[model samples]
Target: MNRRIGILISGRGSNMMALVERADGYDVALVASDKPDAPGLAWAKSRGIATFALSPKGIGKAGYEAQIDAALREAGVEIIALAGYMRLLSDDFVARWRGRIVNIHPSLLPRYKGLDTHARAIAAGDAVAGCSVHVVTEELDGGAVLGQAEVPIEPGDTPEILAARVLAAEHALYPRVLKEFVANERPNPA
Candidate 1:
């Protein structure tokens, strides 16, 4: 069966666009955001993908996640992809989806779990930087890694340059891992 995917985004959604472009044998059922004016929404809509925006600014985290759950269910989304999504999901929400959710974090992961990873790595004098595609768990980026790709941390590289390289890896890794997941037919992680 073709997987039905719902993508959540906050900003430009470069990774989201990569998925959309390569979504063969998969249905992009929905594109959702917490920002009403996310550029990704416009891009998805132009391609005729269903879109939604649920702001948590006033609704609180649990309430917002509930709305997202409802929206995903309504759209029959079988896979949830966090592509530049900024919010940390609630534990309950993570439990509900389990291994059905995936995120591409711009770090080696289990190393730089939170933000500013590039700057931190550069400052720490790391020779390599990378990104990870992992199953989303309640424990931040602590989930099982599905795949990763590394990029050399050239001397004097800025965070922006490092981020670009990581993003390139993400665009390649996410679609490949998603395809592998469907092909292997592995049971969703609990």
Candidate 2:
């Protein structure tokens, strides 16, 4: 049987859509979001995938994550994929999932760890900007990189332009890496 993967998103979830579209050897068990109105939720619902959404504004992180954890477990999610999930995950939450959580960051990684990666790369006069698919560790984006896709930075390229290209790379890279990761990480196979 295919592994059950859960995706967390905070916005349009372009990466999540890519994973859904190109899914192989795994099933999207759930699509949960911190932003209740995130467009991705609607898309998942339309596809008949289970979805859960709750804003952390009022309940605080602990309570919010508790609910999300329950929802994920209920849906039998074996893998957690963070796609455009804006909020920083608490250490406790990360501990619960550990190596089971993976993320797609819009940078080659070990170079740009946080946001504004495209602009940072351009500002640094880098020749290429790309995306990375890696394990989600307690330290931000400081996980073992499973894969990367490089997009050459053309002259006069703005962050917006570079971001679009990098995003396309992410769409292509994430699903393939996730498939391999699931195949390799089966310590507790059912």
TM-score of each: 0.95, 0.98
**Each model's RMSD to truth, in Å?**
1.9, 1.2
Best by TM-score: 2
Q: Tens digits of per-residue lDDT for model 1 on 1-190? A: 7878899999888899999998865779999999989999999999999999989988899889999999998998878889999989998998899778889998888889989999988998999999998989989899989888898999879999888888888899888887776565454532
Clashes of 1: 0
Give the worst 10-residue stretch by lDDT in candidate 1. Answer: 181-190
- lDDT score at residue 78, model 1, on the 0-100 scale: 78
User: How much does candidate 1 score in TM-score?
Assistant: 0.95
Error of 2 at 94 (Å): 0.6
What local lDDT does model 2 show for residue 189? 27
